[model samples]
Target: MDFKTEFKPLTVQPQEIEGKSFEIITEELGEHPFTEQQYPVVQRIIHASADFELGRSLVFHKDAIEAGIKSIREGRTVVADVQMIQAGVSKERLERFGGGIKVYISDPDVMEEAKRLNTTRAIISMRKAIKEADGGIYAIGNAPTALLELIRLVKEGQARPGLIIGMPVGFVSAAESKDELRKLDIPFITNIGRKGGSTIVVSAINAISIMATALK
Candidate 1:
């Protein structure tokens, strides 16, 4: 039996395709609580994930958009939970503002420390990052332990990040980690449940950076 059918894309151009996709997402998503500045990040997340539910589940601090934009424009350093997120962010735009991204999960020092302490590298990486990237954006996606450690750092008053994008994906502690992030009274962008990943984090960072660039 042959179950083949013909399907064609509406547009071959990348920008057109993205534009059309955003239009559909906006039309189908309908009313939402996101503000004018925050909606673009939500829209890009749905565009990247094609999951309206995840997009709608996003919770933002009142200062999230402004804080994220300020960090980018200020050329503050960005720390990612893993290499995938570091690779996915737009380094070009970031460099234009003297900003940059760093991922320390693979660093030799973090690795050695984690092994010595019987802790995950994700946890150690955040520990290292906070010291070096104060007032920076922390983008966590893929490691629940990292997000938990960052939350701990925040509670202890050891971390003063400009914005925290904590959306690690997993069955163990992923959702719980975000719940803890919500308890803090700092600027953050997070979501409900364990439905998050590096791609969505990159989408969010890119959207915020794009907005930041427009201001320049």
Candidate 2:
């Protein structure tokens, strides 16, 4: 069979392509469990990672989106457990609101503390982030230990984050950490199973940032 092997050039703006992608994602997700406001956050997650399972796996506290939006609009710092999560976030979008992303896992002090405590750097970093960015948003997408640390600090009355995006992916305590987060009285966005990553966390923040921009 004779076939043309030439590639065709596309003539669509980046924004248009993104808009269409989101449109297709929404259609594919059809009738998810999220509310109208919450659906946007879920959609953004799916858009970022192209993981439609998020539609089913994602779980949100009733006020998670509201809390996230408030924090983003107020320019609250975004504290990430790992550098990957921090790097994946859209800095330009966050900067518009005078907010920025931070990751302490690679800090010298965090390394020293981790060595002394015999724990992961993520856990030590979270402790420092809690003290430095109190009332900010905590996005823990790589280490379950970090999520656990945040929960412990909050319970001990040492940390009070505006919102917690706990979607750590792993075979270890990822699912368990999310369970603990669900029990907290504070607002949070997490998933049901062990299927989450930096992309999911970044998407959640980007979604909130976009929504907040619309309000301004």
Candidate 3:
């Protein structure tokens, strides 16, 4: 005996499928605390991972939404902790706002410096990143060390990014790093726990970039 089910999707059009998905997401995730501006970003995050808990766990600074939008519209650089994030974001949308993604973790110079300092490439790459893009939006999804280093830079008045989207996934310091990020007055978007990844970061950035395109 063979058990097989024949099924067809509700819609074959991409736009309609996305619209149906958003409707389902909204219907299930009712009465969220996020504002009109913040909800879209949260929606994209959930859409990317299909994790309601992760979507609900999102936290935002007072200026986070507007700051992220402004950064993209102003053509500031966007920094990512890993190549996965760099690859996941919509480059065409980001570049439409004159912004571009930068990832330094694999750069030879950053690698060499990390080895010399006996540190993770994440830590050194951040040091280099701040110099190149002072007001960039940082997307850190896979490296807690990178988030910590950027937080340290913020505390020391050495770096001033427009926004930091930090949700590094791990059991070690991911939650702790997000806690530290919230303490700062700077603009940032983060989650409450270790349940984050490159997809979350990419979704957040893509949402913001899409919003920014309205101004262009």
User: Distance from true position, residue 139, model 2, in Å?
Assistant: 0.3
Most accurate candidate by TM-score: 1
lDDT of candidate 1 over 57-172, digit per residue (tens): 99999999999999999999999998999889999999999999999999999999999999999999999998888788999999999998998898899999899999999899
Candidate 1 TM-score versus the reference: 0.95
Write down the lDDT that model 3 would get: 0.93
Of the two candidates 1 and 3, the one with more favorable TM-score, higher being better, is 1
**Model 3 worst lDDT window (10 residues):** 3-12
Local distance difference test, each candidate: 0.94, 0.89, 0.93
What tens-digit string does per-residue lDDT give for candidate 2 at 1-216? Answer: 987758665844788888898899988888877888888888888888888876579988888889998898888899998888877888887788899999999999999999998999989998899778878789999999999999999999999999999999999999999999999989999999898999889888888888888996
**Per-prediction TM-score, please?**
0.95, 0.93, 0.94
C-alpha displacement of 29 in model 1, angstroms? Answer: 0.3
Candidate 3 segments whose C-alpha is farther than 4 A from its true place: 1-10
Instruction: Tell me the number of clashing residue pairs for each predicted model.
Output: 0, 0, 0
Worst 10 residues of 2 by lDDT: 3-12
